[model samples]
Structure formats: C-alpha cells, structure tokens
Target: MSQFTTPPPLIEDDIVQLSYPAEHILQIKMNRPKAFNAMNNALNAALEDVLNWFESEPTLWVAVLGSTNAKAWCAGMDLKQVNLGAKTMWTRNGFGGMTQRFTRKPLIGAIRGYVLGGGSEMVMNLDISVAGEGATFGFPEVKRGVVILAGGLERLVKLVGHQRACELALTGRNISPQEAKSLGMINYVVPDDQVDAKALEIAKTIASNSPDSVMATLYGIRITDEAGSARSAHRLFVDSAPIKQVHSGENTIIGVRAFAEKKQPKWVASKL
Candidate 1:
C-alpha cells in the first residue's frame, strides 16, 4: 500500500514543477521567477504537496530541489506579499514546507543564486547540497526583525558549529558557495551551468543502488542529529525500523546474490 493514492499532477502551476530526470529520480523546481522564486503561502503549500507525494511514492528514490530561473533559487520570503497581509509563510512541514521536515529519502539542493533567509534555511536541512559558483547564502532574518525558526538554527549550528552559525545568522551576511563548501555546509561548488547536472548525477548514483539499503543508510546517518549521543545514535541506527526492514527485506538478498554473480542488481522501490 503506497500512501500516495493520487499521482502528482506533474506540474504545480507557476509555483512548483515536477519532473523525472532519470528512473527513480525526481526534480522539484521552484517556478516563481517573477518574484525570484520567493516563498509565499501558495508556494509553501505547493512545495509541501509535491514533497509529500514524493515521499509517499516509493519508486521516487531521490529528489533534487532547484530553481527554474537562473537569477535566483529563492530570494527568501516574499516581503511584498507579507506587506500586503500574506503573513502565512508556513505549511504543516514549516517554511517552504521542506525546511523542518525529516524526509525519509534523499533530497539534494541544486542552487546558484540568492539563497537567502528562508531559502538558506531550506538548504540547511537537505541531506546533501550542491551549489554553483554564483550561489550566495545567508540568514537575513535579523535585519528584518524576524528569526530563522524553520529548523535552521538547530541544523546550522550542528553543521557549522555555534561560532560560525552565529556569524552567519546574527550578522546577516552572505557567504559565497565556495565558502559554504569549505565550511561543509554544502557538498560541492561547481560551474553555474553544472549545478543541476551535478545534483542529478548524485541522484542517479543513489538511485542505482538498492532502495531499501539507501533509505536505511539515510536513516542511520540522520538519526545522529536527534539521538542525543554517539552511542544512542548507534543503538538506534542498528535497531531502527528502517534498518530492520532493509536487513530483512528481499533487496538485501538480491544485492548479495548480484554481487556473487557479478551482475548489476535490479533494485526494487523501497517501502520505508
């Protein structure tokens, strides 16, 4: 029983667009080019819907979150919308519907420009991120008399440490993609033209592996963020439901059999 009884509409108006670049790989593009892909209430709801569907559709093993327009991935919250009384910038999942989520599958970021405020916050929680050279990220909430409340504060501090997170969030200064990569906030920084390709390449690689194993691996790694201690995380990782499913599932045996036969394994969609 897949939870997603309805298939995605494939395109979500001018807010979000969905496509499959390869088998088992989904690309979610922010499409609000006129406002630099800024997140308003509609955008938040649309993104949340798409992501919820992606998570439920087990065949979709990995997703790349990016922008359709080159000028900016997201300019953060649409202040004009806010000024006009569109105060709701949140969904059930939080800012942009993805920032505060704990997604079971891998979500990679493909960003190049103007990843600011909530934009930067969304990137903070992605499993892995690839940015283009032109990408600039910052938390400018302080300057606007708001705060980064969408799980960015906790994840950013855990990612880059208290000192660096303080400088980035408190000062409201932008960091280049190169700086972000150096600080381990992002996995790679490549040419602007290759941002999406790089993210897709990684997604394909992940999708080629056993889906159950991949999901279990992601669960094992992400549990550390909430498990309190290394030992606790380790204990939870070994005993977790996802790991148990992977270890006992058909894919485990299939993987071993394929290895023994020296053949590329045909993976099944995970039921995590």
Candidate 2:
C-alpha cells in the first residue's frame, strides 16, 4: 500500500492547498474563494510550484483541481494585479499555471459556477472535467477589449472546432455545463455538491492503474494531438522510449504474473 506523505514547505502557500484524497491522487484546492478564486500573481506562482512537484513525485499518479467554493471556479485574470500589455501577469506556465503548461500526468477538473476568460482556457487543457449542473463556461476577453492570448484561442478551436468556438468566444456568451458537455468540454455534470466527489472518483480510478501505463497513455495522446495524422502518431508511439520503457519495466512483468496467479498486482512506483 502507498502511504501518504507530507507536502514540501513550498506547497504550504494559502492560495493553493494540497492534500491526498486517495493513494497516488493529489487534490489541489484553490483557496482564494474571497476573490472567486481569481488567478493573480501569487496564486499562479503557487499553483506552478505545487504542480511542478506533483509531476516529479514518484508516488503520485493523478491530480484533482478545484476551488474552495462552488460559487465560482474562477473569475479569470485579476485586472487589479495585471495591467494591459504587461507580460508579468503570466507565469512560465500560461493562465492559471495550466493553460500553457505541458503536463505529463493526468489532471481532472472539478468545476462549478462561472468559469470565464482564462478560467475556461484552463478547462480546455484539462484531461477530464466534471462540472455542476449550473456551471457556466465562457471566454469573455473580447468584451474587455482584450483577446484570449493565454493559449485559449487556439485551444478553444481544437476543443470545439472553429464555428462553435467563434460563436461562444466571439459573442462572449456563456454556456451551461450541459452544453459544454455536449461540445466535448465536460465529461460529467452533477449537482453542485457532487462536483468534487465525481472528480475524485475519476481520479482514484486513474490512480488505481499502473502509473507507467497512465503516463505512457497521456504521452500517446499528446503525440497524437500534435502530429499531423493518426498514422504519424501511431508510428511515433511504436518507436517512442516511453512505450519501450513500459514494455521493459518491472510493472509489466508484475502485471503478467499477477494475472496468471489470480491476484491483485502491486504496482511499482513509476521511474518513467
């Protein structure tokens, strides 16, 4: 069994609270509820630092990201903290330390209420999203005389395609969670109180799998999304070191022997 460990002192920031909801599952609660969980400089930095640690932590396999309250997942960038044309508003990772971050591990979003501008941008980048029935999604940057420059414009198009993205992004119209789900932005929609639970449920399922396989699967998805075609991505996956590592790793042998023995397999901490 995997034992929970203490988070490093750097992740002790109030803006980002880290906890283990289950073995191999990291739960990140954005704690700026007073400001509707807006992504200011401090929150962005805290999230980036914690996520950096999460990615490198051998015992951790998946993460569930949510806010402290259900009234709003996030209200987007804080105008009070960031002025127009200012590059300092962004961390090395784009909006919310997530929109532009190239993450290897899977991240599940627990979302509700108004998620606008950069908030929705972060949604597009999540591996899976579970939202409340009343959750709202929008890119309202255009209404503020700004544009979705924090990787939202391109990602939005990829998520829902050109016409649907333009319709919602151009008019700055908000859509219900159901509509977002139909458009492939959300995976599950439940009551507001159930959002976090559903996300955790998904996270634990992923956590139960061999970490090596999970990382390799995500890597394949990343390659497919970036490559020109299925054929190209398939070829890359066949020749990739990640695939080779999974084939030659100890977990593979453990899995095979466990199946033959008719018993549960104890996954080794992934060295990938």
Candidate 3:
C-alpha cells in the first residue's frame, strides 16, 4: 500500500485491499493509512465496488472488515474533501458503501484504534464485531456540525438502548472497547494483535456451516426486525425463503446422518 498525502484515484488497485485468508472468508483492508483510512470520495466508491463483488462471489461466505492503519480504523469521512465541496462521498450502498446495504452474507468488523463518525457507523452495521483493547468508539459528527446519518443513530439505539445511545451521540464522547462490549456494541475485546485472529475465528466458524443455512439465518433475523410486530415477525419467519431452502437442502440430511455416525458433517450446499 502506498501513502498518499493527496486523495488517490478510485481505481481497484489504489484504495482498498482484498484477500481470501480462509476457504470462504474475504478479508477487506482499508489501505489509506496516510489518511487514517478515512472515507474519501474515491475510497467510498472503491469500497462500494468491493462490497458488491463480495456479495456476488459464489465461494465467499463471510467477510472480515479491517484497516491497515494502526492509528485509526477510520476517522470517518474526509473532512478535507468536504471542505473542498465534494459531492461523491456517498455511494449506492451508502457511506463506505457498506453501511446502508442489506447484505445476505455476514460481515465481521475487526476494529482497532479510533472508530469515530462514519467509522463507528460501519461497525454498527456489521453482523458481528471484534475490537482491540485500544479501540475507542464514538460519533463525533455532532462536534463537527453533522449528524449520524449513515444508519448509526438507529442502530446505536437498538444496540445500547435509547438512553445510552443519546449519551454517546449527543455528547460526542468516545468509549473504550470494553465499554462498547458491555453496551452490546461489539462481541469481543482483545489485544490489538488478536483482533484479526478473533474475527477470523468467528468468520471461519460461520463459513464451516451450510452457507444457505447461514444466509437464511441472517435473513430470518433481519426480516423479523423489519416486520416490527409479533404476528408479522412470526409470519415472516415461517414464510422465509431461507428457512425453506434449509429444509429442502441436503445439508440437513447430511448433518443428521453425520451426527448419528459421530462424524463431522460435509456441507454440500452452494453459497447463497
């Protein structure tokens, strides 16, 4: 990764780094260390493309999102770009292209250092998250005369409840990773060096299961929330396509037989 004092081009080779570290896991690293991995217009566009590709890839079942810079996971949108009157800061998928989209596959955020503004919003959208001990999360947009628009406000309220979310959002104060975990914002708080490993462990565990089942499970959970009522949620869960996919798939049969034989199951379903 190259260091650029100025904004880089929005080409595939410049802003983001994509890798497959395990059988079915995609590792996406924000490579703009010089900018604290901030979401400039170009980086935003690049991330949108990468996430779209991740969604379409048949072999990839999970993703671990992280940044190459140790100083900050992301400092949010590039204020420099904003000051320059840039309008391309957002994409079809929203900030960093991942915050607003509904992904069928799961994304696990591996965070460290500063997670502020848009960075915090990205973490809020992750299905699971592992943060380094040094990680600090906040929504400082209020201090900058902005609001948490990229799904953070609502998700924070859901994760930490109304009072806690208001305290964080209105005050523009930062919280340690442990505090975040206590507030139900992240799953684990490990050492900085262990953040990636812990995230990978969780991602691989999900990848080892039936891809269709995993996708369906995620879809079921999200749909229930979207349904917003007991009856509606129950009906959505019962009528879910992923649930039907699991019942009709061979993975269920294989799992039952494997359990009876005291052996690990071989999942044969295609990626969803």
Q: Write the per-residue lDDT of candidate 1 for residues 243-263, one digit (tens) a residue.
A: 888878989989999999999
lDDT of each: 0.87, 0.86, 0.84
lDDT, model 3: 0.84
Number of the top TM-score candidate: 1
Evaluation by lDDT, superior candidate among 1 and 3? 1
Choose the strongest candidate by lDDT. Answer: 1
Backbone clashes in model 2, listed as residue pairs: none
Give the clashing pairs for model 1. Answer: none
TM-score of 1: 0.95
List candidate 1 stretches off by more than 4 Å.
1-5, 9-12
* Candidates in descending lDDT order: 1, 2, 3
Q: Candidate 2: misplaced stretches above 4 Å?
A: 1-13, 83-87
lDDT of 1: 0.87
Model 2: per-residue Cα lDDT over 54-134, one tens digit each: 888888899999998778998888876666554555788788889887778999999988799889999988889999998
Cα-based RMSD of candidate 2: 1.9
Measured against the true structure, the TM-scores of the candidates, in listed sequence, are 0.95, 0.94, 0.92
Q: Supply candidate 1's per-residue lDDT for 215.
A: 82
